[model samples]
Target: MGHFVIPVTGKPVDYVAQIFPKNNLIDHGVIVENAEVYRQANSDKIKVYG
Candidate 1:
């Protein structure tokens, strides 16, 4: 099992959380102030800017 972190911007964090739950398989998302935090946490992270 792998981990993933998705930066939240523009859209509501709840909406993104709905799409990707905590215990789901294949996909997951999280909101962080900095993308580096995600990487530092040792999870794959994606940044969204808008």
Candidate 2:
């Protein structure tokens, strides 16, 4: 959630993969095009992992 791509912004973000580390919040809450990949236990309340 650091400085990164804004969906409404019409600018290109070339360093998206570097913006956030690979974590459950970004995995499940985002990437709406592929829901199945994000599906997993405790994804909704990710504090369980925190």
lDDT of each: 0.43, 0.28
**8 in model 1: Cα distance from truth in Å?**
4.0
lDDT, candidate 2, at 50: 13
Q: Pick the candidate with the highest lDDT.
A: 1
Candidate 1 lDDT tens digits, 19-44:
44454533445554433222223245
lDDT of 2 by residue, 1-50 (tens): 46433222122232223333543234223222222222132244312111
The alpha-carbon RMSD values of the candidates against the true structure, listed in the order shown, are: 7.4, 11.1
On the 0 to 100 scale, the lDDT of residue 32 in model 1 is: 43
Residue 29 in model 2: lDDT: 30
- RMSD in angstroms between candidate 2 and the native structure over all alpha carbons: 11.1
Clashes of each: 0, 0
Task: In angstroms, give how far residue 17 of model 2 lies from its true place.
Answer: 1.7
Query: Against the hidden reference, what TM-scores do the models get?
Result: 0.26, 0.18
The whole-model C-alpha lDDT of candidate 2 against the native structure comes to 0.28
Q: How many backbone clashes does candidate 2 have?
A: 0
Query: Can you tell me which runs of candidate 2 are displaced by over 4 Å?
Result: 1-11, 22-25, 28-50
